[model samples]
Target: MNSKKLKILLSLFTLNSLSLYLYFSSHPDHRRLPSRSYSVSEYSPPHHPLSVKPWPILPSYLPWSQNSEPPFRSCEAYFGNGFTRRVDPLKPNAESHRKISPSAGGGGWFRCFYSETLRSSICEGGRIRMVPERIEMSRGGEKLESVIGREEDDELPNFRDGAFEIEVGDRSRVGKKLVDEEFLDKYLEEGTIDRHTMRGLIGSIRSVDATEFVCSEWIEEPTLLVTRFEYANLFHTVTDWYSTYVASRVTGLPIRPHVVFVDGHCQTPLEETWTALFSSLTYAKNFSSPVCFRHAILVPLGYETPLFKGLSETIDCYGASAQELWQKPDNKKTARLSEFGEMIRAAFGFPVDRHHIPKPASGHNILFVRREDYLAHPRHGGKVQTRLSNEPEVFDSIKSWASNHPNCKLNVVNGLFAHMPMKEQIRAIQDAAVIVGAHGAGLTHIVSATPKTVILEIISIEYRRPHFELIARWKGLEYHAIHLRGSYADPPVVIDKLSAILRNLGC
Candidate 1:
């Protein structure tokens, strides 16, 4: 019972502890659990690892040197009349092709072509460039005097009506001496001739010639030129993103094209949700420093671009039409809308190829997209128009209903998208079995929802638009609409509609 016995006991205890440590180290799975344990939430799914492929990097060489490269051709030879094949004008889906011949001295020429099926226009080849600020047209290495040369008089082209200079004394002018009034006006006009129109005009009028421009960087791969809307609304932004995807598919690009935003207007930078869809993103102004691409495709905005037209009577559904272009007969994997959604999810490191998965055993998430007042941009006053006057009441009703549901687990998620990160918003949408929201831009997240997810849009009579319905149709998701007689939807009515929808899903 003295020092000798204590030493013997300590030796036995130390040997046992060392043996256990060594055993646990060799087989770590046998380690004892910590006092605190974490539980997986029924509604919060695990995030998928980032699986985006690296973007392709093309070689950049000195201007004239790259002309010998595979895709690079002399401007004169490329835009020659004989270079392009003539299509029958009478054909149903005939493409409209306009050829601009080189001026007398031989500077640069371009061909503006429009596809009827895609409803998009693209111009190729030219020497003289007519940008918004500068208008330079060269013929035989000589700068042209006028847009159309006349033998009698040699004077610069006049653009008095279209162009205006900002007066120095004008109060609107903070410090700038000169401002392009034409560009400013066009930019301010929301639906009219915007930066996209100007880009198209410049691309058509401008010429890429061997005589004047030595391509600084000759991009060999086909590039997608996207002109985004100045205001970054989710609905319009989705259209632009979809157009880029469709352009890549139609053009037969082996891989997704590197997206280049051609518009100089910088109202907002690309949102994080959309940035991942592109292999790479760049600005057209980035190329004005004098870069040339072997092939550049300008994707049209939204419905005009291709694939799907929103609420257009002439063509209600173009998703199927676009599917024909890329979906191979043997390939059972990709559907047009589903593939686009997957691409976005993959970019954000979300689970892909889950379109056909069964509902979770734990529960079904009912995501209620809550619209809140926040300044979307600098011009915004942080006051959003009320689509649902009783949004809070409606949300509370849904939450209460979910908590009381008897048949199956129903988890209610308040999707405050504006306050959450884009990836988190996407995760919420992916987790949801049903998404409910008033007729608002927030409902645009339906484009990213899982295939099995259902959409319940409560449209006030004042806001009875087919925006979400059309999107649901295109995405092949089940859609339900509660046409309210006024701005306020009765919570009881909304709950009833939701109950019916859930009952149909066997919930």
Candidate 2:
């Protein structure tokens, strides 16, 4: 099996066990264990928890943007960075791993950018600036709508709170109007292409800090916030933490990050989780009313952050009871890829959701045949030793099934393509009307299928799997199983039974 996929499984298992570790850290289960190698890196808890006080100063307040006609500062306020990698840092001199979208005629305008490379934001903001447009309220609305990136918009993560605010002031506070009509044609308004533009417009940038109040300045009073002392170790937020979001219109807190993932309340600093969080923010669905900032905070027991009240989708998964959290039943585990898939989905912005089809594309019917789908060979990665199609009956059966129906088309995409780039594979599968595959990694692609796609999962009797069935159910696709006797060497047959199953099922 691919180590990366296995790593995801290990991550889930580790999360399930974290509640136990919380217990182990306390008096009832006090015990010390030697350190071991971790997937990312070896880590050992500090002899004492490290202090997180004043956030570190960002590299620079502002920098010169490339090809700029005027001076501007970066709006990132210092988050996002590159993780350790092998790629040459300076290669393709201007190569940026993120896709950014900019707002026009800026005055408190939101500029959007989506990071394409994980952890590649280390040099962020350095290269881009979130300057506002010189706006004169082109159209009137009760609230301002700003898109931070190129795709789908949603309620800020845990943004289960707040109201929109309107700002009407001298548009001059934003940068130059650069009203050249030709500039607008440069950036794309649709599908993300490789085309690159150095524009930095995201959440409305504060022209002058503490000077305005409408998503621009802090209210005179501190926003009332709910917080906790305990939280997940990974989410540990700073003590005396101070932050702010746009003021709430309902209860009227300065700003609240609408909450999501409220499950890990042990504060992971907002800056530390910004990339992952922002990706989710772009993926969040329609908000109710009062869409606003959503943030998460974490803290240690008996410690408190400053009256720092920042709006966030503050997930407070702290102090969860161990019994309710750590006691997980085996086999109940969701797909190992599900979490990463969530991140990717969020990263994908709304393109996937907006493309949701009530039915699979009707253009072509494709069945991907694989040798190990029926069973995961005990070997590592379940390497298939033979051609599944050449086996007397697998292809013949598929051929016969195709011959029986004129409307139903059948095409073959190899199993080798299963682990290929998902973007390309998914694009191909998107065009396939019917997808037939075995219970293997390729089946994971079902997550990208068009609705109404028929999926036939071939299973091994000795190792019947409910995993594919599980995904099919969640994906809302038509799915059924073909059980085969692993020990029976009937030339790996696919008989008329396959036809009966497909013809009877709705796709």
Candidate 3:
């Protein structure tokens, strides 16, 4: 009894399953799902839509477009491997319209298309209107009127005082009209300009005769005397050089043409380095010869880039005309030379502007800069001048760190910079990824280093300055500084701290 019922149920289930399958097969979504797939080679081009106009690429060559180069190759390259072929605009039944109106179908069409070199939208050729007016025609007026559907009655109205007669006239005069009494009176009444003036007790003339082209009295360009009167520090000297911008601003010159009259007292040997630094500004050949001036501006050390508070106050002593450039809200703190930096880079061509120059085949290098030659601190004593008491220990730590990282190479560079040429210095800095040194003027070499390079400054508690910090920030380098406690000749080194920083920076 159970076997017979089970067979009947199975037969009903099979028929129901067959009916459901047939229904789904005929559904529109289901039919579209497994639509015929074709390879790029097998696919055929469809007809162009009525909206787009066909621009044929024919044998008779003509300057069809403003640009001479075709963009098909670029477009094909932009679409990587397995991209569908471009739809032909000239083909009567091209499938270009499928990509034209994204709203109509799938919307991810590469929208740029060029015909003969003229870029045009796939959907843009429909009912384009420029203007609705009667354009002028040089040919027969009657023919143009007929084409424009305008009758003789529709001609523009010609206005006249008496008879409807007016002729197109030619020019009667070449120059400006004569300024007679009436014209002069009209202008005088309007207060536009006052050409007539009384000289002392003499009365104003009615109308003065105009003269031929003549030169007016020349107004002298403002001159600035930038004596080497600034502080003798290297940072101060660099900062003072940038302060020349203030002189430029006061003179109203475009960075050039201003004379940097460096008096011998505070002058450094500007022959090599100063020339490159001040290349954007003009410098006087010799400061010994003084030029006579009816009116001249004197700029002092503390005027623009004052290291201390007393500098700006000194500029005020020169009377009301002297203004401090750094004090202004527009001028950033200190003498930040964005314009000068660009000029220097362009002139000397330091700081190579490459994103990825390969590392030297010798090793992954980290520079340990030596400051034994030049002392950045203003302290006079030789004992105070020498920083990093345990140089050998610090050097060994760096070497040990390098040894741990087999690829890294530690290079100790000190008096080498003073000896090497500027180009060689640039080359050395450009290749190094990380620079380590005591807080000193030697760290300024980071300026020539490639961007994104790391700067590790070993600082002394007694002498802390943001000179190199500011320079590092200006040069777009990663700066990390660690302070050591001591006032001795060489500051004590924290070996563990140094090791951690080196490891964190990937040595």
Among these predictions, the greatest lDDT belongs to 1
> Per-model C-alpha lDDT, please?
0.51, 0.29, 0.35
Give per-residue CA lDDT, model 3, range 1-507, as digits (tens): 599657645654554455446534322121222124333233212212112111111111111111223233221111111011223111111232323321121101111121221111111011101111111111111222133432322232111111100011112211222123453232222121121110100111111111111111111222343434233344555555544433333222322323334222212233244455432222332212212211123342322232222222221111000012213411122122233333334445554234446655665556777654532122223233656767656766666655666435545443245445555555666667677777766566565555446787888776687767656654445778877776332323444554555565455
Between candidates 1 and 2, the one scoring higher on TM-score is 1
TM-score, every prediction:
0.62, 0.31, 0.41
lDDT of 1 at 431: 90
lDDT of 1 by residue, 275-368 (tens): 6776566654444444444345555566453223435443233222223433432121113565567667777888764635776897899999
Error of 1 at 292 (Å): 1.9
The global Cα lDDT (0 to 1) of model 3 is 0.35
In candidate 1, stretches whose alpha carbon ends up further than 4 angstroms from where it belongs are 1-113, 122-199, 202-204, 267-270, 286-288, 306-309, 314-335
lDDT minimum window of 10 residues, candidate 1 = 57-66
- Report the backbone clash tally of model 2: 63
